[model samples]
Target: MKKLSPEILEKLKGIKAVVFDVDGVLTDGKITYDNKGMEFKSFNVKDGQIIKHLRKNNILTGVITGRDSRVVRNRCEELKIDFHHHGIEDKFNVFFKEMSRRNIAADQVAYIGDDINDLPVLRIVGLSATPADGHYKVKEEVDLVLSSEGGKGAVRELADLILEATGTYDLILKKQ
Candidate 1:
């Protein structure tokens, strides 16, 4: 994990919600399909593990992706994410709507995305992040560039940062 500067820490402290872009941010931007048209995407358990803590701490989590897949939906369900919207062409609009619905301000949300399509929401969010292997443009636009690559603990890294900043990580560890 990269060191968090005071400014970044402050931003993380205000993050009441964290939204993710699925393909490159959650998976490794890879998709595999069998001859029978079955699709597969691998997600990191480390990433999934942190969501429970986030929820326990009352931090909202969501997924918004341009592509729809049963696998992704299943993962979101398993994680008990507060929101999940797939096949979204206009991500910013959907994100804005969700934020409004939940009464969460834009400045209280953090978003992680790895592609150009994610720009609209990333740019507007209070804290924007991307994986180490994210597209160059996305890396440039994001507030934090994670040390881990996609599907290999990038989301966990971000979640850990948020937990640490919010002082939830220590509390969780003490309960262990």
Candidate 2:
């Protein structure tokens, strides 16, 4: 894949909101079931911190997962994600809503996704990013392909790039 384009980087700099697709982009794309049928997902601590950093800088962040689970809801709550849309078969709806609610236009939004289901939003968003583990079709359509796999700090990587471009990453990290 081509390296991230300078044009793409410039576009990412204007992002005031970031959105992600959950099961894959946030959880390594693996679904585990317990004896009682409870579902579980693993989220990176660093990703959480990145989201906090973005929010602290007045940038809005949220999630739109295809599956519905308390685990996702809890994670969103922990991250203080304002627009949580789970069990969304149609990602564009949630995507458009979040953009409108945040008062951020499509050109000012970046979306991280991992599979064919994410193609629509990825195609329309200004900056589209895919994890290393994303499906081939999804990667083909994205503007940037991350070196890290989803749920393995991919979100953090994307967040860092966006924050850096916006010139707010260092400021946020100074508090750490």
TM-score per candidate, in order? 0.98, 0.94
Clashes of 2: 0
The list of candidate 2 runs beyond 4 A from truth reads 1-3
In terms of lDDT, model 2 sits at 0.86
- Regions of model 1 farther than 4 Å from truth: none
RMSD of candidates 1 onward, in order: 0.9, 2.0
Write the residue-wise lDDT of candidate 1 on 1-59 in tens digits: 35778899999999999999999888998999999999999999999999889989999
Clashing pairs in 2: none
> How would you encode candidate 2's per-residue C-alpha lDDT over 1-176 as one tens digit per residue?
23567897798788888898987788897878899998877888988888988888888888888898999899999999978898999999878877887678987888999988889899998889999999999988888889989999999999888888888878876867
